[model samples]
Target: MLIRLKELRLERGYSMTQAARKIFSHPDTYNRYEKGIREIPLDCLITLAKLYDCSLDYLAGVSDQPRKYGR
Candidate 1:
C-alpha cells in the first residue's frame, strides 16, 4: 500500500512534502504513512482518494482492479 502511494506520488512528480501539503498532513507524518510505519486513518484515506483520484479500496490493497470501486 505504501509502495503504491509512493509510486503514485512519483508518477505525479510530487515530493513527499508536496503530497503532505496537498493532503494537509505534516511532511514527516506523511512520510511515515508512505513508509507503512504508521497506519493511515479513514479520513486521511478519503482525503488521499480525492487528492490522487484513487479509491480507498485500492490504497488499502483490498482491490486488485486498476481503479477502486464500491468503497
Candidate 2:
C-alpha cells in the first residue's frame, strides 16, 4: 500500500504537497498515508484512484492492473 501510493504519486510527477492539495489534505497527513503511519480513509482512497487513473484494486494491491475497468 505504501509503495503503491508513493509510486503513483511519483509516476505522476506530483510533489507530496501538490498531491495533498488536490485531495484537500494537509501535506503532513498525506505524507503519513504514504509512509503507512496512518490508515487511509475510503473517500481518500477513491479520490486517489481517480487522481492517479488507477483502479481501487490496484491501489489496494489486490490487482496488478492499473487501469480501471471500462476505461
Candidate 3:
C-alpha cells in the first residue's frame, strides 16, 4: 500500500510536499505514510483515492483495479 501510494504520487508528478499539500498534511507526516511508518486514516485514504482518481480498494491494496464504476 505504501509503495502503491508513492507510485501513484509519482505517476501524477507530485513531489512529497505537493502531495502533502493536496491532502492537507505535513510533508513529514505524508512521508511516514509512504514509508509505512504510520497508518493512514480512513478519511485521508479516501481523499487520496479521490485525488488520484482511483478506488479506495485499489489504494488500500485490496484490489488492483484503479477506477470505481461510474466515477
Using lDDT as the measure, which candidate wins? 2
Question: How well is each residue in 1-71 modelled by candidate 3, as lDDT tens digits?
Answer: 88899999999999999999999999999999999999999999988988899998898889988888675
- Kindly list the per-residue Cα lDDT of model 1 for residues 34-58, writing each as its tens digit: 9888999989989987788888777
lDDT of 2: 0.95
Ranking by TM-score: 2, 3, 1
Q: What lDDT tens digits, residue by residue, belong to model 2 across residues 1-71?
A: 78999999999999999999999999999999999999999999999998999999999999999999996
Which residue pairs in candidate 2 collide? Answer: none
The deviation in Å at residue 33 for candidate 2 is 0.2
lDDT of 3 at 58: 90
Prediction RMSDs, each to the true structure = 2.1, 0.7, 1.0
Taking all chains together, each candidate's TM-score versus the true structure is 0.88, 0.96, 0.94
lDDT of 3: 0.93
Candidate 3, which segments miss by more than 4 Å at Cα?
Answer: none
Predicted model with the maximum TM-score:
2
The CA lDDT at 43 in model 2 is 100
User: How well does candidate 2 score on lDDT at residue 20?
Assistant: 100
The candidate with the higher lDDT, 2 or 3, is 2
